[model samples]
Target: MVKIKISSLSFNYDSIQALKNVSVEFREGEMVGIIGPNGAGKTTLLKCIAKLLKPHKGVIYLNGRELWSISNKELAKILAHSLFEVPKGFNLTVLDFLLTSRYPYSKGLWETEEDLAVVEEALTMVNAKHLVERKMEELSDGELQRIIMAKLIAHQAKILLVDEPTVHLDLKYQLEVLSILRRISKTKNILTVMTMHDLRLASIFSDKLVLLHEGKIIAIGKPQDVLTEENIAKTYGVKVKILKHPKAGLIVIPLSTL
Candidate 1:
């Protein structure tokens, strides 16, 4: 299984410290959610893992190699990140847009049969086959999210880092997107790490949850263990009830401000 080990990772954006002495581990076939309030360094941690931001101290290892030792092209083949935004300036049809991500294997501007087949498979996996003909700019928020995911799938990366997958989406779309990520993580044996703001959804969908507050991990483990009422109150500054659901597993209910 693919393994990611982070140790004593610290980061600073000029004068403001974004992360501090953080550490965690992620394994393949598990969907881990990083949940926290604003300014909790959730995005910074992801950037550090993706090597988009250089940490000031400590190290991160993927498998056995240091994260910084991997070249950009090599990293792209193993790790891919998806942001909660649409592709700007593309304006192309969804099918054509997704084809742009296959440049790693195609190695040329021209499309090959392999590229076509892979893009088609990605479109099918993300359930966006019907939207292939639609323009990237014309899709709804939910549809755009699916297309973003399809681009990652087409990348054929083993590690997926997604930022705020459910932002700006309605309840139905939120559930749909998270379910898709969970399914693909287990079926494809990819290590999926996503940052989420919705505690209840994260608790239900994630196999593991890492709770961060002020750039440090408050708790990390199974959702039922890490998402306790005390941890929720400590990190979020809100009182909540840890409720057991017969169908949805554990759910969090916000009670009042502490």
Candidate 2:
């Protein structure tokens, strides 16, 4: 099985430090959510793993090999990141956008039948085939979100790094998107690490949770273990009541600000 092992990872933006000696491990078929307040280095952590941002001091191993030693082209084959924001005024169709996900595998300037097949398969996997011909400017928020998720799946990477897969959507769409991501992690046996702002949703969907506070990991383990009342209080500065829902699993209700 594919695995990610990070040790002593540190990153900085000149004077400002983003991550501080953060170490964590993730495994295949597990959906891990990184939850913290703003400026907690959630996105920075993903960027470092994707090699979009270089870590100042750290060692990241992907499937037993050093990540920095891996070529960018080879890394693209194993890792895919989805920063799911609806692009405005982009004159592109869903099919056109999804096809771009095959750039790493494309040999020619044009797409092959295999590429088209993969695109179609990805759309189907995300239940977005009806949106294939729709323009990017014309999709509803939920539809556009689905298209973005399809684009990520089209990459066919083993590690899926999603930055806030559910954002600016209604309750229905949020659950829908999260459910799709959770299902894909198991079905594809890919390691999914997403940064989520919703603590309740993170607690319910994630097999493991990495709770970050001020660029450092305060807790990392199973959702039940990491999302304790004390952890929430200490990190978020909020007094919360964690409820065990009969249907929805863990429910973290913020009772008051500390």
Candidate 3:
């Protein structure tokens, strides 16, 4: 089902245009990676969808309803955004952090038994149940990411917008994080859209890819169709060789700058 439809979206920051006439459609059970150089408006597009930023022009529809028309509390139930940075010096336990996602639906300051059950389920879904008692400050980058995913699951949001999910991670963690995201997208039937800088990882895991350039969408489609050398060069000004991966099926290797 079409979970999101962005039509002619445009945004500006003071005198600077951040996103320009961009349009895209996302469906349930799909993971889409947004790729672009800095200033290409990838994050701006997500912020618009999350309603954190109002567009200068255009419309965003969530599950056939206008996004802006929905109340924040109602919208919170349908959409969630996972950020890149892990909070520093946070004293909350992993379970506590995940439980916060339920605040929108909470009746009071105390969490009911049902809320605890939801938190446990979300933790298990992200394979972070064992970390429930761990302090947020003690977890590694990867463990923190898993906790973030758990929070999203607890939110029970049908659509997820993640920005730079793999930032500051080693190769192994990057792979693990993307793999987890792909699984979550399918298993939970969530429409997951993330901004990523690693083109190779995006190609390997995303069901579809969106390439942005100069605040506009240069391409959007399946990985095979959108990750072409020509498109990469045009959007990133970098030359790359598209190679066949035995497992990944297709991999993009950067060759040189244009």
Please give each candidate's TM-score: 0.95, 0.95, 0.93
lDDT of the candidates, in the order given:
0.89, 0.90, 0.87
Q: Candidate 2: lDDT of 67?
A: 90
**Local accuracy of candidate 2 as per-residue lDDT tens digits, 79-187:** 9998644467776788878888999999999999999999998889878899999888898889988888888888989999998888888999999899888888888
Clashes of each: 0, 0, 0
Q: How many backbone clashes does candidate 2 have?
A: 0
Candidate 1 lDDT over 1-258, as tens digits, reads 689999999999999888989989999998999999999999999999999999999999999899999999888788989853457677778887788778767776699999889888988988889998998888999999999888888988899999999999999889888888888888899999999998888988888999999999999999889988899899999999888887787778889999
Q: Please write out the lDDT profile of model 3 over residues 39-101, one tens digit for every residue.
A: 899898989999999998999998889999999998888889986344767776787677789
Clashing pairs in 3: none
For candidate 2, the C-alpha RMSD (Å) to the true structure equals 1.5
Higher-scoring candidate on lDDT, 2 or 3:
2
Report clash pairs, candidate 2: none
State model 3's lDDT.
0.87
- Regions more than 4 Å wrong, model 1: 84-90
